[model samples]
Target: MKLMHVDASPKGAKSNSRMLSGQFVEMLRERIPALSVDYLDLAQDPPPHVSGDFARAIYTPEEERTPQMRALLEPSDAMCRRVLAADALLFAMPMYNWSMPSSFKAFLDLIVRGGVTYIAGPDGYAGQLARHKVLFLTTRGADLRDGSPFAGMDALTPALTHGFGFIGVRDPWFVDAQPLQFAQPEERAAGLARAQAELAMVADRWAADVMSEAA
Candidate 1:
């Protein structure tokens, strides 16, 4: 199977999402020895924001697309094609101001192309590219657990889910690495330990599921 792994953290080596994503990729490799993985680091080369020309390219039919319009849309088309070719997607997102980073948002804007990923149909907007699974790993500095005063859910999760689902990715898994900020060293360590343990459990479950499916 082919997996597209996207690293959205700008912190480089210091990113918790990067660390966790590395572990997850390693675990996936162990589970599927022949798995093909493609890594895309958004922080290194972020896609440009959508422009008027790009918008025109998306709305215009292929027969009517001008050379200038196609040039403006080529990057986004390539990005969306990569996503469409993959069987699964792994997103390593770090929480920035209770949402996704600008790099991730930029990537999203590129992939959600009109007519390619979704279309304006009689029944409203319909997602045309909807045949993949996604694993979203998010790292946050503070707790957002249910019922806590600071427990507001990150907007990124819902936004991404809806966007991807609109184009056909319905099975989405979320792995949250949270509460990295703390007053004491001990508290920070404890939180990290908990996240590590949870990661292990998730890996085990994924391995078992893959094995069962293979059988």
Candidate 2:
């Protein structure tokens, strides 16, 4: 199976999300020896933000698009093709100001194409990647767990869920490590541990699915 792993953290080696996401990918590799990986590091090589040219190009029918329009949209189109080719997707990033980082948001803007990733039908919308599995690994500054003062304040989770669902990942998995920056030392460690443990289990399940498909 092909797995597309995206690291959206600007912190590089200091990013907990990256560490956990990489570990999960390695676990999958261990289980599925032939698993192919496509890695994109947003911090190192980010796609350009959506521009007027992109808007014009995407809305224009492919047959009618000018040469310049096609060139302008080629990068975005390639990103879309990568997503479609991948069997599973993994996104790792730290929440910034209660939402996604700007780089990751820019990346999403490029890949979430209209006709390419989803279809807006007369009745409703349909996702093109309905069968693809997706995982979001996020690190949050504050604790948003049940009974915490910050409970119900996780705006990032719902936004990601809906955004990805719109593109056909209706049941994407999320493993969020919170209270990393604002909690006690022990609490941070505990949260990290919890995220790692959950990721291991998720990797197991994903690997099993891959093996089943191969069989």
Q: Each candidate's root-mean-square deviation in Å?
A: 2.1, 1.3
Clash count per candidate: 3, 0
Off by over 4 Å in 2: none
Evaluate residue 42 in candidate 2 and report its C-alpha lDDT on the 0 to 100 scale: 94
TM-score between model 2 and native: 0.95
TM-score, prediction 1: 0.89
lDDT of 1 by residue, 31-141 (tens): 778678889999888889877777777889988988988888888889988998887788988888888888898898898877788888888887765656678888878
Worst 10 residues of 2 by lDDT: 206-215
TM-score for each model? 0.89, 0.95
Over 4 Å off, model 1: 205-215
C-alpha lDDT (0 to 100) for residue 82 of candidate 2: 94
Return the clash pairs for model 2, or none: none
lDDT of 2 by residue, 41-129 (tens): 99999889888888889999889999999999889889999999998999999989888999988988898887899988997888898
How far in Å is the alpha carbon of 202 misplaced in model 2? 0.3
